[model samples]
Target: MTRSEATPLTIAYTATSAEPGVNIAALTDALTHHANSALFPGDGEVTLVVQGRAPVTFDLTPMRGDQIEADMHKKAEQINDQLNHMLAEVAAHSEILEASTNGLDVLGVYDQAIAATPQGGEIVMVTSGLSTTDPVDLDAAGDWQLNPSGFVAQINPRDIPDAQGRSITWTGLGQTSTSHAAGTTDPTSTRARPNSQQANKKLHTQHAPGPAARQALHDLWLNLCETSGASSCTIDDSLLPATPTTATNRVPVIEFDQVTTNCLGTFTLAADIAFSPNSADLTQAADKLLAPIADALATCPDGRRINAYGHTAEVPGSGDGIGLSTARATNVLARLQQLGAPRNTIGIPTGYGDTRPTVDNTPNGAYREDLARLNRTVELTITN
Candidate 1:
C-alpha cells in the first residue's frame, strides 16, 4: 500500500488529430483519464501536444503515504494536491482526443524513468519488470541498472518497455537536444526531449525544454487548469509595458498563427460530424465538433484572427445545401464564446455553399462522398 520515492517518472502527450486551439480544461481532463487508466505503482508526469502548437507538460513528483496520522498530516495533503493537479491536466488531454482528434491517432507517448543516482556508478533501467515473478520490484535480475553504454548484457535493450507499455523501436533511437533516447545517458543528470511522436510506434517522445522554458510552461499549464476563463489573468512578475510585447503575462491562449514550428493553414476537421434529421441542427453530441474550433481559439488567442467558415456541396438532400451550410455556420459561431474564444478575435460565421469547393462539384454525373465531405468541412481562415 506504499511506494518508494525512486519510482518518479514523467509522462507527456502530443495531440496531432486536432488543431492547436484548445481549452486547458479539456487537456486537463484527457490527461487525468490517461493517468487514471495508466498502470503505475508510483508517481509520474503527464503532457499534452497539439499539431502546430506549443506543448504542455506537468511533472507530478512522488509522495510517500503512510497510515500514521503524523505522516499523513505532512505528506498526504501535498500529495493529494499534486494528484489533483495532474488529474486536471490529464483530463484536458483526453478532452481533445475524445472530441476533436481527426483519426484517433497520436504521435507518441514519451516516458523517461528517473532513478536515484547510483553510489557513483553507471545507471541502468529502473523498473520492477525485470523480475519474472514480481514485475514491480527493482531488485530483479537486471533491474535498478542504468547502462551508460546503452548496452544491456543480461537483457535485450530493444525488448524493454518503459514503466508505461512503450517500447523503443529502431526508428525511435536518437539523441537530440529536444529528447533523450532511453538508456543513452543517466536521465538523473541529463535533460532531453527526444522526438517521441510517431516514430515506428514502439515509443514516443516530448519537446525538450530548457530549465527556464520548462518552468514557464509548467506555470502556464497550472494557471490554465486552475483558473476558469482566465482570459485576463496574469502570472509571474512582469509589468505591463507602455506598448504591448510578448513578455507581458496574461492568461495563456493558443497562438496557432505564429507557432511557425508547424505553420498550419486552413486546417480541416474530421468526417464525424452529426447533423440533425435532414437539418443543420447540430445534435447534442455535435457539441463535440466545436472542440477543435475552441482549441484553435485557445492555441492562437493573440495570433491572427479567424473566420469560422461552413461549407456544403450541391447534392441530393431534402434541404438546400446552401441553407444547411449557413445554418451550420451560425450554430458553430454561437458556441464559440462558450469555448473561450475572445469576442473580437473570432469573426462571424460564413457559409460557402458549393461556391467554393476543394474538388469539382459540377453536375456531370460525378458526385462522390469523399469529395463532398471535403467541401462539407467546418474550417478556419485568417480574417481579411
Candidate 2:
C-alpha cells in the first residue's frame, strides 16, 4: 500500500458551535476503514492538529507493519484508537471554548498544515467552514454569494506557504447546527417523544443554509484547492453528497452554439465577463474570464475568420447604444488577439445594439434589470 515510505499525513480539524451537521463519529469510522485499506501507507507518519484561537498539534504513532498483513491490521487499530481519542479531546475543548467570540480559523490551520507537510504528503481538513478569521471569513454575509472563480481570484497564492504538489481533502463544509440548554434532549430525537405543547415550543436554533449557499461553499473550497496547486483534491462530505446538486446563480462564462455550414463555431459571453455601466473597457477580471476562450480559439484550424458582435440593453436613457456596443465588440476582439487568437483572422466587429436581445426587455409593462443584463452580451462567431 506504500507509494513512498517518506510521505507524511496531516489531519487538521475545527469544532465550533455550528458543528451539529458534522458527524464526528461517522468521520472516525471512515478513517478507521481507510487505515486498514491501501489508502493509508504503512510507513507514513500521521499528525493531528486541532484549530482554534491557537492551534494544538499531536504527533501520532507511525504504522510499522513491515510486509505482514496481520501486523498492519494491529497497527491500524492502534492508529484508529489514537485518532478517536484526539477527536474527543478536540470536541471537549471546543465545548468549553464556544463561549468566546473568536471562532475557529480554518485557513490559518490549512496554511500551517501545508507549510509543515512535504510535497507529496496529504492534508485532510475536517471543518464546518464557518471561519471567523482574516484572509477568508466564510461566516460573512457577502461570502454566501461568492462564486468559485471570483472567490479564487481574490486570493494570492503566494500567501499559502509550500502549497504546491500537495493533496488536500475537505469534509463537513457549509454545515451548521444548533443546540438547547444542558439536560434538554433533542425534541426530534427518536429516544424522546415530548407532548404536543413541548414539541410546538421554539428552541434556540442555527438555521442550516440553503442548497445554493452549500454549493457556493463547496465550490469555494474546490477552487481554492486547485489554485493552491494540489496534486489531487477530494471532498469527504459524509453527511451530504460531495457533489452539489443545485444550479448556481451566475451564468456560465461562455456558451457555445450549434455548429452550422459556413460557421466554424459561435459562442455567447454573458455574465462571465462583466462591464461597468455604459463602458467598453475590460475589467481586471476580464483576462481570467477570456483566457479559456482565447486558448480554445488558438487551437482552431487556420484560415477561419473570427468576428465579434455586441448587443446592448434597451434602456431609453442609455446614450448611443450602437456606438457603445461596437466599442465593446472591438475591445473584446482585440483582447482575444492579444491572448493568442490569430490577429490576421479577425473580421470586422459589429454592433447589433438593442436589436437582438435574447430575452424580453420589459414584461407586463415592468422593466426587469435581470433580463436586460442578459440582453447586454457579446457573441463571437468563427466562419469559413
Candidate 3:
C-alpha cells in the first residue's frame, strides 16, 4: 500500500481522563504503546493529537531557602534525565513518518520526524494547541484536527486531587520568558560561556551550536532522522551552552566566577500553581510566582535580554509534556512582559516540552508532586 493508503496519515490521541496527574511520561509511554499497538500497526505516518490537562508547575521557593531550591533543582535534573531517555527511545523506535509537534522543540522532534519521513515528505510543524488544533498537512490538502474534551491547562507543577482528575499545573502557562526562548527572530544567537554552574554546563560546551554550526547541527539531525528509520535522538543537556549570546559566531565560554549567575537566587514553591479544573490559565498565586522573575531580570546587568528556556512534564503522543512545555514557555514570556520586561529584548519562549526529561518514567506506579516538579522549571540565562 502507498504511504497514504497504509494508514490514516493523521491519527489523534484523546486521553481517557483529562486530569491524569502530572506523570506525563507514563501517559506518553502508554499512549505511544497504544498508538503503536493500534494505529500504526507496524509503521506508518504517526500524527497524534494529545488532548488532556497541562502537566507542569512553575513555583519558585521563598528567599533564604537554599535547601528547597537545591532539592527542587535536583528533582529537576532527575526529571530531565527521564525526558532525555524517552526522547532517545522515541527516536529509536517510532518510524516518525510526517509528524507535527504542539510543544516539542526543533531539536527534540525535528530529527525524529525527519528520520521517519522519506525524501519529498512534508516538513513537520512544531506549534502550540491552545484548544482545538493546528494544521499539519504538508501536502496542504489533509485537514487535521485535535479536540480536547475537558482538559485542564496550567503553568505550574504539583498534583492536586479534586472531583476533577489529579493534575499538576503551571501557574505561569501563558505568562512570560523564563530562560532562553529562541526561534527564527531570536535564533540560536551565540554559544557564549555560562555565568553560573547550570549556565556553564549548558552555554559553554565546546560542541554547542554556533551560527555557522547550528544549521549543520540542525541539518545533521534532519538527515539522521531521514535515514534513521526508527531510531531515537538524545543529547546531554550539559552539552548545551547556558548563556546563549546573540552574535553571528560562537562566543567563548564564560566561567562561573566571571558573572553573578545567581540572577534568580532561588525558586521557592510558595503554593503550587493550580489550574482551573481544565484550562491553561494561571491562578492568582501562580501569577504571583512569576512576578519576581521580572525582578530577577531587572537585577541583571543591562536587563535588556534574558533567555527563556521552556520545559514540560509529559503528554500523550508528543512525549510526556512537550505540549505543556511550549504552553508554559508562551505563558512565561507573556507573564514577563506583563510584569514589565521590554517586549523586543525578551526572546521568544521556546518549549522542548516532555520530549527531553532528566529522569525515567517507566516501571510501576510513579506519580507525585516532586516528580512532576522535576519537569516544571524555566531556566534563565541572564544576558548583558
Local distance difference test values of all predictions, in order: 0.35, 0.57, 0.32
Local lDDT at 305 for model 2:
77
lDDT of 2 by residue, 349-375 (tens): 999898876556666656777557657
Q: Which 10-residue span in candidate 1 carries the lowest summed lDDT?
A: 243-252
Candidate 3 ranges beyond 4 A from true positions: 1-279, 315-320, 364-370
TM-score of each model, in listed order: 0.30, 0.47, 0.28
Model 1: per-residue Cα lDDT over 162-258, one tens digit each: 3222211111111111222321233353433122222233322222322212222323222321221211222211111111011101111111111
Residues 127-211 of candidate 3: C-alpha lDDT, one tens digit per residue: 2111122121111211111001001111111221111111111110111112332221333335332222334333222222122
TM-score of 1: 0.30
Better of 1 and 2 by lDDT: 2
Per-model clash counts, in order, read 45, 0, 79
Ranking by lDDT: 2, 1, 3
User: How much is the lDDT of residue 300 in candidate 3?
Assistant: 61
lDDT at position 126, candidate 2: 75
- Tell how far residue 140 is off in model 2, in angstroms: 4.4
RMSD for each model, in Å, please? 22.6, 17.2, 22.1
